[model samples]
Structures are given as C-alpha cells and as structure tokens.
Target: MWELIQSNRRKSLILFFGMGALLILIGYVFGSYYDPEAGGVVGVFFAIVLWVILSALSYFAGSKILLAVSGAKEVTKDVHPQLYNVVEEMKIAAGVPFFPKIYIIDDPAPNAFATGVKPENSAIAVTSGLLSTLNRYELQGVVAHEMSHIVNRDILLMTFAGVMLGVITIMSDIFFRGMYFGGGSRYRSRSSSKSSGQAQVIVMILAIILAILGPVLAQLFYFAISRKREYLADASAARLTRYPEGLANALEKIANSTHKLRSANKVTAPMYIVNPLKREGMKLADLTSTHPPISERIKILRALQQGVSYNDYQRVFEMIHGKKEKIIPDSVLKESIAVTPVIGLTNEDKDFNPIEARREANDAVMKLNDYNFINCKCGVKIKIPPDYNKPIVVCPRCGTRHQLR
Candidate 1:
C-alpha cells in the first residue's frame, strides 16, 4: 500500500511541476504578445492568483464544494440505512482511518465519487439513482471503489491538476479574447529596429499558437493521469469487495442508464465513477478518455477467475490487453494479500425494495431542503413547500385536510 501511495505521490509531483511549467510559459508568451515590457510579470501574477485561489479552495473546502455542486444532501442512517452499512463495511475492508461522511445527490444518474485531500477526513457522495438501482453487493462495489480513491490519496492530485488545467484554459481564453478585441494591435512599430521587429512578430505568432493549444495539451495531461488512477481504483475496488462481478455489473447498469446527470458539469465530470457529461459525438471509450472504457473495465474485472488481489487484477488486466504492462505497481503487487468473495444473501438484500428506496431517496433530499411531509390516511404523502404560508393543506391524492407544522 505504501508503494502505491509513494508511486502516486511521485506521479503527482511530476504532473504538478510539468503542468505548472506549461501554465507559466503560456502566461509569459501571452503577456509578451500584448506588451513586450513588464506586462509579462502582470500576466504571471494573474495566473498565479487564479491558481492559488483555486488551490486553496481545493485544500480547504473542495469536498464540500463538490458535493454542494452536485446537489448532495448529507444523510444519516435513518434516511438510507443500507447505504450507511455498505460504506461502513467498505471503510473497514479498505482500512480507511475514518468513516467518511455520506451524501446523496437527487439526480437519477447512477454515479458516485470520493473527495478530500486526506484519508483521515473525507466524504463519499452517491446519486439517489445509484442507491435505488444497485443491490447491496453492487452498491458495495461502488462504495469500495470510492473508498480506494481516499485510501490511495489521489483526490488531492486530481483536484490540483484540475485547478491547473482551469488556470491554463482561462489564461489562454483571456489572451485570445484580447487579440480578437484589438489588444494585439499595440505589439510592434516602424520606429523599432528590424531585428527587434522580427523578434516581436515571432513572439506574437508563438503567443497565438500557445493560446490555441494550451487547453488541449493541459486536457491530455489531465486525462492521462485520470485514466491511470481510475484503473487503480477499480482494481482496489475488486480487492476490497472480493467480488469483481459486483463492480462489473454496477458499471453495466450505469452505462445503460438513460437518465442524464443534470448536476454534472465539465469540471466535476472526472470525479465521478463514470463520465457524466454527454458529448454529442464523442466516444468516451476511446484512448484519450478521462475514464478507461466501461466495457474494457468490465471485461478485465470479469476475467479475474483465480483470486481477489492486486496481483490477480494485474494478471487479468494483462491477459485482456495481451501485454504484461502493470496496472498496480510491482512493489504493491509483490506484497499483496488475497481474499475470497463473500457469497450468499446479505441481511439488507432479503427485504430490499427498489421502489421504497427510490421514495426514500427523494424524501430524504426534500427533508434536507426543508420540505415538510404529511402522512395521509389514504396512503398518500403530501410534501409541503417551505415557502407555503397557509396553516392547512389538502392532500392531492386523498383530499384529506392537514395542518402545517
């Protein structure tokens, strides 16, 4: 496990510096494009400010912000006891130091994600669609997968990488907008030396090119690392649940779901267990995707026939890819411990009701948002809006009169 952590840290450092250098270079070029003087310093200052503000937010309030952005409401056992139990089981299995706070998003898209810079304090948020759709074993697989992200300490890396990518995009956008709006008109003059004029023109061309390519290069870097970490998280999920099929099935259902994740945006798409954004013609299963192809992930997981361990997943991964390239680092694989799948029905499964679960999900989110619930005698429940000023309400279904509390 230390080897895994160490490897991630090493990769994160390289990504940090590599992308940081690209960001600084873009700033210098664009700054020089506008003013060949100290404008470069001002440009760098702006970039730094944007990066620092976002970085600080990531370190301090990232988890909260992401959950809020996803419209997740904090939930207790009473709201969804099965989800609580699943998360607790995974927390113990993964040996995470703390029991992460749980949240439920109201969206019908079946997806989940983990966030927080440190393992000691973190959170796992899942959409209500996931809760209502997945069975206990399938849900356990997803929770374990999210738990792995916390244990492996890659949340910070992803967060900061996203921040850097955003900064580069913003810097490039500003430069291009300036050029389009006549900021580049002040670049050179006939009074300057011929050699100086030529140099200025060269800088302007380079600036334009950097502004165009900056976001694309940054996205590639971000997606490359994102895909690697995702594979690792999947392998860890199988290890923790000792049931590769569980996660494989979960992925299948998620991929098949038609319900769009209305809460997802471009920035938060990578944090999800699957890509939530729907591009018109983009094939997310391609090589440059933010996530490994769902079909490929399912195939590899389903191929693990022998044991449940990092080594087993690695063998399966290689077998499917027809190559020996390692997904889990060598040091970690050498020291891996194995577990067998726990079969049979869990207590939560016998009485599990998807309809009830769906209702619970909706009710819990409404309650958290301050909506009042009224139980009618005719089995119809009425939800009173928070802003309703009337002292009494009539049930739409039962036509029963109820007083607002």
Candidate 2:
C-alpha cells in the first residue's frame, strides 16, 4: 500500500509538471503567432504566471471555493456532534494532525467529498441527505473513505490537477476565440519574417491543435487519475475502519440512490466519494468515467474475508475477475499483514439516530434561513415561517394562541 501510494504520488507529480509544461508551450505559441519578436518569451512568462496564480488559488482558497459552490455551510460540533465525533474518530485513524472541519449541504443527495491542499488544511462536506440516510456506522464508513483521501494526499494532487485542467480550458477557449475573431491577420504577421515563415506556420498549426485538444487530453488524464485514487481510497478506508461491509453497504445505498446532487458539476463531481452525476451504462473500467463502478467497488469490499488490507483487496479483485491483475505494489503485498476487524461502533455511535439527524438538519437549514422556533407550553414545538404575515399563531396540537410578532 505504501508503495502504491508512492507510485501514485510519482505519477501525479509527472502529470502535474507535464501539464504545466504543455500550458507554457501553448502560451508561447499563442504569443509567437501574434508577435515574432518577444511574443514567445512573453507568452511563456505569462503562462508561468497564470499557472502560479491558479496553483496558489487551488492551495489557499480551493476548499472555500468548493464549499461555497456546493452551498455547504460550516457546522459546529454543538449542532451536529455525531458527525463531528465520526470525523474525529476517522482523523485519529488516519493519523492526521487535526480534525478536518465539517460542512453540510442542504441538498438531500446522499454524497460526500473531501478537499484541501494538505491534510492540515482539509475539510469534509456531506449532504443533508447523507446524514439522514446513513446510520452511525455507515456514516463512519463514508467519512473514513474521505479521510483516507486526505491522508493519502489525493486531495492535493486532485485539487491541483483540477485547477490545471481549468487553466487549460480557459486557455483553449481564449485561443479558439482569438482564431475565430482574427486569426488571418495573425498568420499574415509571420510573412513579415520570410526566414521563419515555415517554422512560424508549423508552430502555429501545432499550437492550434494543442489548444483544441489540450483540455480534452487533460480531462481524460484527470478522470483516469481520479478513478485510480478512488480505488486506493476505498482500500484505505476499509483498512482504517476494519469493517469492509459497512463501506460496502454505504456504497450500495449511494449507488442506488435516485436523488441527484443539485450543487454538483463536472469540475466538482469527481471529488465526490461517488460520481454525483452518473450516466447510464457507465462501466467500472471506462477510461472516460471519473469513478470505478459502484457495483465493482462494493464487490471488492464484500470479497475481503481475510482482512482489510491492500493485498486482500487485490486478491479479491483478481479472483472476482478471474484475472491476475495487480492493484497493489509487489513490495507492499509481500510485507502486508492482517488487520484486526472493527467489531462495531462505540456507545456514542449506537446512540446516533438517522431520523433525528434528518430532522435536525432540516431544522438547522430552516433556522439559518430565518424561520423562528417556538416551544409551546403544551409540549409542542412550532416552526414559524419567515414570511408569515399574520400577527397571531396557534399551535396545531394544543390550539393555544401565540403572538407571531
């Protein structure tokens, strides 16, 4: 598993640097096509600047941006202590320095994701639906999956890659728009230098092709990397929780769920534990798909009988497929040991009720939106709508008149 992680890190670094270099090349070609004198150098410099700016944004403000886009609100432990406690437990299991902040989205879609530049800066956000749908142990399984992502350094790599993909998309759009608007004049500029005309035309042609296909290639690579990491995270989650069935059950629920996450988009969808926007007929090994098939994932988790380790998962994967594909590094497999199974949840977890959590999440969202709560003397709590115009209110249960104002 450690070797697998190292391999992932190495591949990620290569992809990041490779994509960055491509962006720089695109910038140079773009600049040279227009100005033959210093345009190429200026373009490279500009690309570097843009890359730096985007990387910084992804590192510093990326989590905040994602939270805001997902309509996630930071939740306090006092509000959702059960969720907080689960996160803390997983944090300890992952051996992170501190507990990642927790956020809740108002959407009823049963999905969750983790994000940040590093473990110390990480955060986990889950939909209100997830809280309402999953029991204590099930929720722990999901949280553990996300914790594994953070501890495994998938967050940083994915976030940076996503940002780089964004840059490529933007640059591609700009190039195409420039071509559509005034490409002929730019091409004619090359005629000013006869000695370099052929070279200039070749560079321009390559630039156009790259700009056209850069985003597509980058996105394909991004999805491929993301899918690989998802498998790794699943194995790590099972290892951390020592209860493979819990996560398997959770995955089943998530996969069968019909609710679509409203806040999910193409860019953010890959960050989720499962693809929030799934298409019909998508297979586990689809190169274009951002996640492995949920059925396949659940199968892998359920097949683990020996213990929750990478070697166990690999063995099951190969057995289930009747193939000898290696998912874990050879070095890690030889050194792998059995992990103790987690028998069950603690007392606090046993006390967690999904129904109550759903009600609590609903009430929290309502309160945040200016709904007023009134505890009546007749053992009934009434929620008053924010826009209610009447001055008086009566408890439906007790017929007691209350002042609305």
Candidate with the greatest TM-score versus the true structure = 1
The alpha-carbon deviation from the true structure for residue 249 of candidate 1, after best TM-score superposition, in angstroms, is: 1.2
**lDDT minimum window of 10 residues, candidate 1:** 278-287
State in Å the error of residue 2, model 1.
Answer: 2.3
Candidate 2 ranges beyond 4 A from true positions: 1-8, 185-195, 321-326, 329-335, 340-354, 363-405
- Assess candidate 1 and give its lDDT: 0.84
Highest lDDT model number: 1
lDDT of 1 by residue, 77-127 (tens): 766778899999998887756989999888888999998898877899999
* Tens-digit lDDT track of model 2 for 218-319: 988888788878887888889888988778888888887899999999889999999998742355348788998888889988877678887788888888
Q: Give the lDDT of residue 222 in candidate 1.
A: 90
Candidate 2 overall lDDT versus native: 0.82
**Model 1: runs farther than 4 Å from truth?**
183-187, 279-285, 342-353, 359-363, 366-405
TM-score of each: 0.86, 0.84
Model 2's TM-score against the true structure: 0.84
